[model samples]
Target: MLDQLRQIADGLGQTLAPFCEVVVHDLLEPDQAILAIHNSLSGRQVGDPATELGMARIADPDFTQVLANYANQFADGRQAKSTSIGIKDASGRYIAALCLNLDLTLFRGLQSAMNQFMRMDTEGPRESLDPAGGADAIRARIDAFAGRHATTPRALRTDERRALLSELRAAGLLDVRRAMETIAAHLGVSRASVYSYAR
Candidate 1:
């Protein structure tokens, strides 16, 4: 089954040539997981060690069918967009892995061109006085505050809540009608509790 999948990897690599690098890994051997490779963009050859993603699958059985796209770089420092998929066996153990890496240098150039074509001129912008916008802004502020403290809005302590309310009040966000109710809902707390924080 793994060998058949390696053939699929080869076909995929050939179909997406030049920009795409396809690799197949056998997870049974972490040190030499690269069973087959195509395009060879990363300069990694067969018999190479498994990547961090493969090791993660070995460590966690639940780490199956993971599909993530993130920034990657080639040996020559060229930017790439990479996507990896983990394949598991019937026993819930990861048996194989396939990764596709796409070089993005040309796409970056195209993005720059598109941006230049859609350039916008600065206009005198008017301030929004919508109550809903104010509520959203307040919620964003609360989330940001909680994130800075390494916690969620609902998980903020009393003192943290008080400080957050104070900051909202200072920013005039709490002056909007029903802003307190919105904040309370976002924090998963009662309206009375939000009032207490305001005090």
Candidate 2:
């Protein structure tokens, strides 16, 4: 049974290579329960002792069979997402477990990097990258419209929204490149909705 499980662990480890660690624990030998380990992220050896999870399963037959995407950390504090699956014998007693631990360091780093790359500057002086100053013009028109209506562009009423679109169209603001996108972004509506309103 353990041999078959070892084969399964190896196959899964290969498929999830370089990031995931697959461990097969022999619950019957809790003192040294780690029967096999592949991908080796945690630096755990084959004869390593069972974890608290293994002990928990041993103590309770009704313990959860599958625990997925639970937060875990290595000894060095690298973040991990893990899934643990329990195996039971013919009599329904938990016999072993298969655990997959995915190292999230690279993924977390990528997430942080992407966030930094996409973050917009909300402070300092306003700068318009548009050579036509179309964005500035749009903001000015919306501000004037809002100032006249005693409300913000996003807070404009349904009737007021139609009036505003009319005002924008008369000012040729709708003719600017990607004007619908800019207007919809400020007004918190879809481009299709903005085009519909303009019509």
Candidate 3:
């Protein structure tokens, strides 16, 4: 199982360009879930005793209330956003978990900036409307977005652009229809002008 996990992790690292790290944790023992299959961590591992217990007892009916979210969601802070999946055995028994931590600070930052814009009474030059924090804030959003979407850093075609936009919307970064309009406006066009691009 450990060997198979390693192969899966390695394949994930290859397939997902922004995937910076992959860690597989064995859930066989409740107390030793913290042990990494391959220990190459630089800082303190992210672990909460309560969270571990919550994951270990997933079969318990009450555990649902304890941890309602077991899927990916945007996290805020220096290290935010991870693609996490709970691994299960053939019999549908929980066995382990796989966490693929990707750099998404820019996407998260852009969402924050958008929120700030929505709150303001007016819209003007982006720089003029920027928060008092200035470039640091802007950089975070841009960095996160670029890192998360432009993994290859290659120029994206219209289809790629639309695909990425769709992903962002699904991730709750943008509204379904409004996001289309926003992208259209960015390209100096209308919503109809972008549909073909998406196709």
Candidate 4:
């Protein structure tokens, strides 16, 4: 049952690859941390944090906060909306759990469309990330960028912003172009708007 759930999540991740990333974790042993799968729009595989380059070691002090998040949210699947249907053996003793890390922003639109078309909420219960918080993060990043480069009205040009965004991606401040899109979406504007600001 656990394996089946993982496969299902993997398929969903692939299907939704165009707009977001999906991550799966096993909750039976929260610390075990199996990254069942992740798919990205930029065709980048989500690497295990432990093995990924430049990522702070999972064993670092900051790992405690990560663990706390896992225990508080990931383990329960309540805030995460990942679902924790028990994985049990034939005898019914609990074994493990399955989690789905869905991108709420993108999925919500598809879900609404499906609900409208089906005339029902086939979209199950959803726990979504704080889109507002994400937006604020982008604003903060923009402020930081402005501070770094002496931003002024003159700096806010389309081509300049695009170049800044491109530079940020190259510098690893942003991992993929989708990150730019996310920031743009959060700004309640087009990617072009964010690109202009980036200048």
Task: Quote the lDDT for 7 in model 1.
Answer: 90
TM-scores, one per candidate? 0.56, 0.61, 0.37, 0.28
Measured by lDDT, the strongest candidate is: 2
Model 4 misplacement above 4 A: 1-5, 18-24, 27-29, 40-82, 106-199
lDDT of 1 by residue, 1-199 (tens): 7889899998999899988999999999989999999999889999999988899998988974867778888989999988888888888888889899998988899999999999866686766666576787888999999999999999999999999999999999998878988999999999999999999
Report lDDT (Cα) of residue 147, candidate 1: 98
Candidate 3: clashing pairs of residues:
105-144, 106-141, 106-144, 106-145, 107-144, 107-145
Higher-scoring candidate on lDDT, 2 or 4: 2
lDDT winner between 1 and 3, please give it.
Answer: 1
lDDT for 20 in candidate 1 is 91
Model 4 residue 146 lDDT score: 59
lDDT accuracy of residue 44 in candidate 3 = 27
lDDT of 2 by residue, 15-99 (tens): 9999999999999999999999999999998999999999999999999999999999998999999999999999889999999
Q: Over 4 Å off in model 1, which ranges?
A: 117-199
Report the Cα lDDT for candidate 3: 0.51
- Which regions of candidate 3 are displaced past 4 Å? 14-19, 34-58, 61-76, 106-199
In model 1, the worst 10-residue window by lDDT is 124-133
